[model samples]
Target: AAAVAGMRDNNAILSSRDWARRDVLMQTKCAPLPREEGRPAPRPLNLVQAATVASHAWPPQSTCETLGLTALCDTVRSVAVNREVIAAVSNKNIFHMLQLYVNGIKAAGIKNSMVVALDDETAAWLKVRDVANYVKVLRSRTGDTGNHATSGLKFKVLIDFLSVGCSV
Candidate 1:
């Protein structure tokens, strides 16, 4: 009851229609506007200005490149299945677990599985093995050492996949 009272005081409650209208307004306000012909590119926003921007700009442009989201989307499209199976692996476990994992998926006749390689070496290894078709190398900001290090990255990976319209 106290929580509900607090939320009401904060104006946090709204009807579904009100929430839908708010969403439309936010999308309209935050969307990048088209530049008029011959107009100079807008100056880059300073730190303060950027910080003030809406959260809707999320999965920022740099994140897309760093995660190789476009490539992942392409790989997902190549699979005919409605859902995709993703295996996130770093070079540390490539030899120890990748083959066994891939074999299991193959034995099950799953055609939509793909690997999200956490390092360049893993990507290279996949290419050399001629099984790089469904692999997408995700560039990590900090070097990922093992499963523990990469575990925290799952949410970000899932967000990027969602942004690209892929279902895992």
Candidate 2:
């Protein structure tokens, strides 16, 4: 196949591991490093750098605050979150980074319920909702072309179901 041959031709420029590491939040050389003093190493930081830091901090919420993210997590009639949302993300391994989104939040009892869990930061992010209340599940980048937007798919309810599955 041309695609396979092209990949072989460009092997010198590509690392097979790159395909696996793409989704990872890699630390930059300028970022903090471990120190013998039992503290994080001093490193350059900026706004974008701060965002990168926040997502991996001990508690994700603190990271969001560190970056001064304007997304307010609050109660609304409905909210949308990318499936990657997590309340307390943990990296067990390269492939085991837990996505904290609403489901994990509920599982952790961080909030009484997902619908009511949106706080000041997450609320501000609702504008870019992925599913926007569920009528139609967010379509895959490659899926059916029905283009039919169904009605009445509740995200909170679905999140609850997902939570239930995890408990089992």
Candidate 3:
């Protein structure tokens, strides 16, 4: 509430109709770039780092290794995550990697229903996305707060896949 009020008051005092520096996006890394003829030197926010949290899942854009996603990704207005060349990640700590990948994706708002197979050599990829965009279009309203605790879910995975899947 205070932040919103501050911006409103600021817009009035500063006679200029627009100020890029004070965009709310500044607080979150999601701020859009200013439209200017001259390019500003690249900063951390300017660069979209592929939020790769999976220690076992192949690094960013490894999902693009296939010809299909790779080709489709190019037609987009801009690219954020593209993991085409990377092979599926393999590690002794597969569960840790999965947790990090899941948490990191939560941080960036990425989601997907890629079913992972235990014996399959290829790893599935998930993409980060903005929930607000989808939420606005949704006519129904419900509490959307999500829980990130992995304490119980970890046990379930281990119990369900013990004999068939990776032990880690």
lDDT by residue for model 2 (78-142), tens: 22222122222111121121224543343433322222112233233332432121111233245
Task: Report RMSD for candidate 3.
Answer: 16.5
Model 3 — TM-score against the truth? Answer: 0.23
Question: Where is the poorest 10-residue window by lDDT in model 1?
Answer: 1-10
Cα lDDT of model 1 by residue, 62-132, tens digit: 55576667566555556524334455444546466877776655555556667766666677776666453
| Each prediction's TM-score versus the true structure | 0.50, 0.18, 0.23
Over the full model, what C-alpha lDDT does candidate 1 score relative to the true structure?
A: 0.54
Scored against the true structure, residue 95 in model 2 reaches a CA lDDT of 15
In terms of TM-score, which candidate is strongest?
Answer: 1
Those runs of model 3 whose alpha carbons end farther than 4 Å from true positions after fitting are: 1-32, 35-37, 40-92, 111-168
Instruction: Give the alpha carbon lDDT tens digit for every residue of 1-168 in model 3.
Output: 123524554235554766643445446434333534565665533212233444234222454343223322231212223321111222222545655654544454333212222222212222222211100011112322122222223343333222111222
lDDT of 2 at 149: 18
